[model samples]
Target: MKAKNFLTTGLVLLATFSSVVKAQVAATDPLINQVSHLLIETNKQGLVKAKYASAETRLADLIKAGRSDEARKQMSDLISKIASDLATGQVKADDLKNRSIVTAKKLQKAQLEAVNQYVNGTLSAQDLVNTLKPLNSHYTALVSVLQRYQDVLRSGQSTAAPAQLATIKAGVTDKSSILYARFRLDLLGYSNDTTKDTLTDDLTQAITDFQKNEKLTADGVLGSGSWKVLNQDFAGQISQLRISIDRSRWLPDNLGATHVFVNLARQQLQLYVNSELSMDFKTINGKLERKTPILFDSMTHFILNPTWTVPQNILLEDKVPMFTTNPQKVLDLRMKVIDDLTDKEVDPFSVDWSKVTENNIPYTLVQKPGKGNALGFIKFPLTNPYSIYLHDTDSRNLFAKNDRMLSSGCVRLEKPFEFAEKVTQSMNMMNWSADTLKDATENLSPEAETSTRVKLVKSIPVYLFYLTADVNEKGQVILSNDNYGIDATTYDIISQK
Candidate 1:
């Protein structure tokens, strides 16, 4: 069932790419026919290609052409003026106020074609104006992010940190470095209310707090580990922002009225309600070797007191080896070995250990729900090919650590019970809430130990993406590490296309 859904989504994406490739370069073919082969020579040589250099060259050609000057100028000015409104987004205060439903539908169709303008080749001056006008309307918010950084680059000032100093402890006499460190700490939510750059006691406390929150040593010393994190300047962030904007072109102008949006690159999950952000959570995604694939699926149900059916790879590589190393640990864990063909429990001791291998494992291994169960109390199951689901973890300590890419092809929620409640209420799943889920899983008796899947009133969409940079609540750019090693590759893909 998951496989079918995945295949369908893959087909849709491939179809989108096909349409993007074949889309007409002109809104009206006659407009392009009127301005055919209007090429810009880019007369200036030996000069570094600036941010809007291409647009500027095209503008000059249009001014020379005289006939298409007004049309081309509009396109050039729009690209140049995106930085005017950075914080409020290029969107109006209300979604409906700025949108022309009839125009928006046409713009959506044209925006899909505009991506090919960068990929296929040059466009005549008039056709470029027509193609860009609709795209500017539909993709203004996304385009603004790209243009914001472009404006920064055009101004000849780089936001990337220029240098890093040697290990400077708390009592350092260098005021310059200390002031910079204080700024970094303040940005990280560890504020110190001091005007002195002498590293006061209050500043030291802030440094220690920042270190603790980042899962670093609480020594309050400025060292190599801390410097790496402090150096995320805007110049560096723009590259990923460009990549994110390109990827956003393929997505819907609006994701959904309500949806679960997960950025695997950032290792964060967001829940949107009524097209507005309602809650966000820290998430642990799949590890490097076992990647969490990008999926556009829906959450159909959740399980209470969930039992884990160990997959074949884990059964051979993890469970079998661990149990073989210490047989007594198996009994302590309350693991059950069952026959593969029949729904019958088998005695663990009776199985011949010497015969078990990757090629010939004829039994299923399952862990019962309770303390030390891999899934802590509750699980939110989604339909996907990888059998991936969102659930609580028994190892809650990992949540404090900064690097949270530690799961095996599934997501671990920071507050699973709370998430379960929000999702159930939102989806009308059994008219449930946090308290109801708490009552269902709190029972300690054997009668309530088994897995119970509750159906949803309506399935909720979940989108797993790879956005590496995005705006914050205050509308400032934030960057994330490239956990999946796709930032560069994705950048290249978008640039080529």
Candidate 2:
């Protein structure tokens, strides 16, 4: 069998990390030392060895020296999470299945008891390590996946040599040209043999799948439309896809059969129902100054005609002082001051005017439900710590902009009410599906000036991510611009072999 020669010298050179670049991280690195201190202990037993042995040896060093602030935070989160799961117990089958490289087999009785001992502080670190030895599979999976993608790129398997090969079809006896088409199909994960050179039934169907995804004519023919994309710089884009796949390693393999998937890079949200694409919406995410962190949480419920309570940070930074100088401005907008905890109405005059600053604002300022609420008429709330929800925006015009990353951090949905309605309808467990919605008052009303919390009968998962390169419905490899400049920064860490 003739071997595939795909790796260009340039790609191999680009893929290899320099020794100097590798040495940026030293033993004295603060974060590394911090991770070490947690993993290492004197005369440790059970908790510190074997299972955690991988964590001790690998987790800290997984992060490279030139890591960006966002990448640093992500790495810190990964280590902290591993430590947390280790300290508690690893239940890999739950929603956090992707938290490690490989899935640890179901725990046996003795292993479970050892973990219990660690939880109660009765067992040593090595004890914890030995008991949760399966947790090491997470690192193994991570390393293996990372290595596989890097290997594909390093071997020059993804890139095709410059060629003006003749257009080839399934029945045509064009072995050499067929090899070129077969090569691309393989890189994109459709396995076919280019060495055969002959277009087989499998290769034809593979091209059809690729063409269907690419939104081209799926006639089992390789022509101009398919040829142009086939010869483009897909090798680089494959690396981007690998990064996205790796990110999912921290999430459930099935991100909920029915859930909302938001791609921060594309500024788009995809609603999936039974694994089929249902609705896709344009989303405005965080600006660079207030970059949005990727989040995975369930959509427990939605709020209708919801009053917008000004968040503490926004009140301090933008509103409090603005209102202090011109108290009438608050009244003009129908904004009310409310007690922080109870959320009951409070008079603006009851507070000392001089004491209100960004750092010292005591009361919550909320906008009434009419047209002026920053969170349009409804909100789809994700149960996350960030308090970032998917909400409608007063500035619908902003969606037309090419760069839709204009929000502080929460996503601004173009058709938020529609989305909320769809979700409510899906949750037939609730009495508030759109058909019953008209009679159901406070289902996110346009007139309620105060906040109203509407619960769902069934919870839907929401995954906020930045997948810059993805295979779209057209099956074409689409790569969006790195809106937050993350791809360049995190490339080294993710791309390392």
Candidate 3:
């Protein structure tokens, strides 16, 4: 497959680190020695080793020539290269999976030592800054998670093929498939009645739980989606890890003391307060065709009983045709058509129905908030080019499904009022409490003409990310469905051989 230049921007940003180390300390300084040791250790582990040799040689030459500035630049460039390679998993080892784990851990340890040395005043601030400029929080988290992933790889268990699983009878399947299923379930810590050859009631419950954890239908039966994730080979799983790691590296090291994180891959939202996991809940993201963009922004405020203005695309594709077919459908849904220039509600029946094509529709459709409203009862507005936000949905049944990618683009929260209360308290919004928000929600009515807007005194950071692989509390690898196929596409681009 042809490779896309998606890494071009990242590489350019990495190159900007060339000037980060401006320290003119002598070549014989202990800080220089520390950097040299780090380089040697990194090379020994074959962590993107080949590309750094020339830079290291140049740095050595500069040091020997008493050119401290040049040496610092060379060192910074080399460190940047190492960081870039770590982020991309461009390992040079013959056995990538096992070798990458070693390299990642070594680099992680070296980074920590540098940080500690700086705190102890053994290393200069300049050197420490340059050393850590590239290794962000994502890099540290990725290294830790990658180490845990090794357990899955080391299990050495093979899953049944899709074709084989498809042919399994109720109680007559071969033991090999059953054993594979049991071993996988056991590995994931959802094991039950392993002594039985068939999928007993306990084992079925385990499967149901596993399916729910993986964000799939909890039918207690192994379906195609379950097999697809279970049957991923070691290399494929590693690719997913690498892809998620690289994607995470794009985010800021400090996400903030209190922030909201939406992992679209898992269809989950987490609220962190003072860097602690405060709460988490199920969220419905955009559909595959209309994917919710991966981005970060400050959630400035939330609207109670918010109105929904149909976007141009949605207007043209869905509403125009519906209104054209049956004009009464507009009032039936409590949507008002306002004239573009007059700023006044236009009667849908007054418009020339036959002439009003999607392109010729000169009015905007705004859905009033309340029962059956698209935006539901609340909307957490975020500043992003995609115009995406966290919102409520009256169709609460959608949350019960494993796959909740059912929106146009914005995120639909299962518990919007609860989320708003937490955000308000976390941000120290004045004159509001959990019970206050609850009362407002309960009192809100379909006939409410205007929404109650509450702007926070300070905005809270929010990140919409897509990470396909994560570790559970037990440190077992939990992989989610790559509904957007981003993992496969990005892995192909970055892992090009």
Best by TM-score: 3
> Which of the two, 2 or 3, has more lDDT?
3
Residue-level lDDT tens digits of model 2 in 128-208: 555443332223243333344456655656455545577777467766678877776765656677677887888888888
For residue 81, give model 1's deviation from the true position in Å: 25
- lDDT tens digits, residues 1-497, model 1? 00112211222333332233224424422323222222111100000112233444454345445536464544435332321112112221122221111111223345335423522344444454344332211133434554544444456643444265545574578766677676555544456653566868877777676665445788988788877765555434444554455344334445777788877876778887776777887888888877676666788778888888888887777778777667666668878888888969887777775567988998988888866788878888887656778888888889877778898878888877777777766765655677777777754566667777888778788877665655544333445677776655443332321
Give the per-residue Cα lDDT of candidate 2 at 132. 45
| lDDT assessment of candidate 3 | 0.65
List clashing residue pairs in candidate 3: none
- For every model shown, the clashing-pair count is 0, 32, 0
TM-score of each: 0.64, 0.55, 0.67
Per-residue lDDT tens digits of candidate 3, residues 1-497? Answer: 11233321222322332222224343345445455444433322223233444565576568767887777666666555554454334432222331111113223566667756653447664565456443544445554654444444446544334347642235646665666666667655565765677757776777777877876777877766776666566455544555566565555667888888888888899898887778889999989778887766788889987889988888877787787789999999998989998999989898765676656868888998777789887889988756689999879999988788999888999888778878777766646665677567646564554688898878898888777865544444567777887665555444443
How displaced is residue 50 in candidate 1, in Å? 13
* C-alpha RMSD values across all candidates: 12.1, 12.5, 9.7
Model 3, runs deviating above 4 Å: 1-80, 85-139, 148-211, 216-231, 353-361, 428-435, 445-449, 472-476
